[model samples]
Target: MPNTQRLLTARNIWMATVRPNGTPHLVPIWFIWINERIYICTAPESIKARNLRANPNVSVSLEDGNNPLVVECTAKLLDKPFPDEVVRLFKSKFDWNILTDDEYGALFEFTPVKWLLG
Candidate 1:
């Protein structure tokens, strides 16, 4: 199981993925922890989404204030899309009610390949 407690309260993390040309792309994203999974959502057409599709390898960092623990993953967008549980949890925890149904349709789900609490 993931270190659910730590990740759930983490304010933000730098989500890093490799670009097609071999450089890293990093962006700060808010994430939610559910069950044994760390769930994050992003537009399916985003650059990071495209990069992830090209190379499923990704890394996310959660910090204890300024100190960071990095988790690595190889993610695949779920064919079935985000389930209602995910949507509810996401909105409840993160206040993401901004997304309309059409926007929500663009979401993708990712799972961690590995996590390192350093």
Candidate 2:
């Protein structure tokens, strides 16, 4: 297991999704790390969302290029009415209320299966 302290303190993470054609699509995103899992918000129609729907395998890493902490995870989209605790964490960490935003798309919960800290 990765050091929870380090993972939680990181400001940003890079999420990697596989395109339909097998290319890697990566983007920086805001995330909440709780209970050893990572939660991220993205548009339902966005490329990352679409890619994850097609393939659940994903990789996330801290933005520190000098000392990378990478994790391999499986992502699943949560149905309507996301967990209240998750919503609260997002609000507290990002100061963004996902619950009240109609523009926000889907919320994805990622469970880590592997870790690589360098």
Which prediction has the highest lDDT against the true structure? Answer: 2
Give all TM-scores, in the order shown: 0.79, 0.94
Top-TM-score candidate index: 2
lDDT of each: 0.70, 0.88
Count of backbone clashes, every candidate in sequence: 0, 0
Q: Would you list the clashing residue pairs of candidate 1?
A: none
lDDT by residue (7-115, candidate 2, tens digit) is 6667689999999999999999989988878999988899999999999999999888887789999999999789889999888888999988766668999999988
| Per-residue lDDT of candidate 1, residues 28-107 (tens digit) | 87777666555666777788878888998889887564665777866666555467777787778777852464543444
Model 1: how far residue 36 lies from native, Å: 2.3
Off by over 4 Å in 2: none
